[model samples]
Target: MVSGHLFHCRKNSWPPEEYVGRTALQLLDLDGGSPPEQAWRRRLNSHANILKEFSVTFMEAMKMMTLGVRLWSYVREEASHGRKAPIDPFTRERCKPSASQGVPLGGMGSGSISRGFRGEFKNWHIIPGLCENSPVMENQFSIFVSRDSGNKKYSSVLAPGHHEGLKKCNDSGISSWDWNLSGQHSTYHALFPRAWTIYDGEPDPDLKISCRQISPFIPHDYKDSSLPASVFVYTLVNTGRDRAKVSLLMTWANSIGGFSHHSGGHFNEPFIGDDGVSGVLLHHKTAKDNPPVTFSIAACETQNVSVTVLPVFGLSGENHVSAKEMWDTMSKDGHFSRENFNAGCSMPSSSGETLCAAVSASTWVEPHGRCTVAFALAWSSPKVKFQKGCTYNRRYTEFYGTSERSSSINLVHDALTKYRLWEEEIEKWQDPILKDEKLPEWYKFTLFNELYFLVAGGTVWTGQDRTLDLNSPASTSC
Candidate 1:
């Protein structure tokens, strides 16, 4: 009979007080026993030996059964909650019973029931809105001073045009500039143009004096799988003489993306000098695979500039797996020991019996020593199924048991026997308990819970309906 503890959690709760010391022989009527009942007794005796080896008591065994019942109830509630009736819940239209069926149970034989497709359509609306009036395309300026001799020693201040000219100059000129002269009388000053200006032939004492301008880019399509999806960066350098410092500030006119929103994309600062030089970095944000968005810069002193862009991408599918589900499954079953867990589990097709897939990615910053900004992207595909005649059963016992027929018979028979045993136990106690002295609230609650569980537990056989079409072709990609 069902254990009393299944009705309540009081101490000494298993097998009911009356059945505590009874032997199998005492509880069974040998004269009226059937083959199935005899087999059950034998199995119970064998299980008892194993339990004894572990020093497990009858009560403990009963607890396991009770726990199983609870789990069954939970599964039922999960399957039924918020579920609409099948298209033909009461009709045998699509889910006719199998030809050899004998009172099928559970969800067996449920025919292909499509759940429909789901996906995120890439919308360029936000991108256009962001790009339309963006202020990133503007050009700006900055300045750096090496010395502060009251601006008297101010010679030829290096400007943005200098870098352009130097790039076109011969090796001798480049070398001469590299060997920049120092001293109050020295006339030659090293100048790196293009966003930087050297004043008084000395590095700015206030390195914080830097400014930026916003410029909107002409709407142009920029596509590249290797480029950053969202952000970009630019660097600036100062080759002045004095210990100059400057504050850098940036401002821009709103454009496609709007300055208020895209303004934060512009970052400027004094360049780090390994041996006494100056520079700054600029970062920009843009849509994936799009052309470089533009912006402007301004500073008290110009510094050599470099640009770097970082990309971002969409989130991958595997990330959707719930943390709680993963944790619980891992805690109960340990890490998935499957040889290819790291390789990735393939996704199963909508109608596949099984699936296999994986997801991964790599990232890097843009070139030219630009801003230190970042972006990322990820993706995943549908599940793929085993090929026809692949015989996956040979590698996975859980799929088909020890051997096809052997495993099938074992599983079906075990389920049937367990169901029969539970039913019998319920029958033995139902009438008496329902009519006996008033039960405590807790006891009533527990008993009803167990009864509901048994009534709704997994079926021994699946009805004629098949929810998935295992015969269909597997998905080509995930």
Candidate 2:
């Protein structure tokens, strides 16, 4: 006969009955009225019957109940804790990404950038084979609107609660901007290589905005996936009675590891590609002849949309003149003045300083009309160096050649031209799995969420060995 608190029989029974093994757990049902208690009783009885059918002993029941109690406590704490979790739109299931990371920007082994679910781009990893997870204070994406009733402008950063800190906008210009959008007005959904954030509600009852960020991460597409680039496609809908003039602004700081130590400082130049793409290139000059790394921010030109670029701007908001100028230009007409468009400013950063560059795309959306504008961010940092004087070439250099030979403009052109085909390939690969009815919903969610590690884990892929074999079939090789 079993002893102790777990093996006690009911008050009326002197000797143990046939269901004695199962009654050990049922004895734990003390509060019969509470919902949690009732549910726990059902689960405990069900588990006890299964154990009794398998000939489980009283001691086994004690151990299993002990573990189950601890698990139940953890679940209660997580569910009843502060703030509810976000829900997936399709599955209507609770979805919260670990560490607040949404789908990242960039291909595998091509240094990626982490864009938080709140829509801020942080965690700079543009250096070849190096991880820089610090958030650059000046990197921002803003939206400006001009409607008939009034004008509305926002920084577009979304968070759960409103921030309370006082920001001196007069002193720092753009640096003092805060996350003004409330969490209830937006929804962020991440499905690996693609993440969508839908913004609606207060601020503008007639405007609905959705941003889809995509990285070229198709299965078995090594060449495209190895390129360092990401595309942001914004779709704006005007649900109001009047037309709306909307502009999307993207700003990035000239940041690398500062390993180059080149003279004459950093600079940016506007480029109008032969394909009609217009943007600016932020050049990090390392060598006198050729810089080691370059960043390109570009937008696709359409019939009714206008694209503008700010070649150079002060990095800090403390530069009152430059910051206010940038903010005012975007706020006024949803466009940057072309007067300083091509003005090449030499920004000397001897003491760990870097300048900023911006590009804007603006257009008018009629009442109940929809419009889409696409932008791309590309980097050309082919040469990778490590500690102890070791150097290697990234896999992307095999096609684009060395850093000296390739430019970020070439990367931008490739990404913009081929990203549609890449998206098609991604849909083709994922459709079957997503449509399957037998697979559990949680299993499908985990499948794509696991792919985040491919890029955000400080991934590095070196060039393949060229001298392995002749141009023969696979059967010919050993």
After the best TM-score superposition of candidate 2, give how far the Cα of residue 315 lies from its true spot, in angstroms: 4.2
The TM-scores, one per candidate, come to 0.15, 0.70
lDDT of 2 by residue, 1-478 (tens): 1122111112321122212122212321221100110010111011111112124588987877876576556445534753121211222222122334567788877566787665556555554323444455456667777776665444443332232222444544454444456555455556667766556542465677666677889898888888888887777778778788888888876665323322447667777774657788877765433326788888877897888888777635443236557777777667876665566544554544456788898899898777887888888778654322345677788888875324577888777777778778877887788678886554454566567767765566667822111111110100
How well is each residue in 276-360 modelled by candidate 1, as lDDT tens digits? 1111222223323322222211111123322111111011213232222322222233222233222222221122111111111
lDDT at position 336, candidate 1: 26
- 337 Cα displacement, candidate 2 (Å): 2.3
* Ten contiguous residues with the weakest lDDT in model 2: 33-42
Off by over 4 Å in 1: 1-141, 144-241, 246-478
In lDDT terms, which candidate is top? 2
Clashes of each: 111, 0
Q: How close to the true structure is residue 27 of candidate 1, measured as C-alpha lDDT?
A: 22
Error of 2 at 296 (Å): 1.1
> lDDT of candidate 1 vs native?
0.21
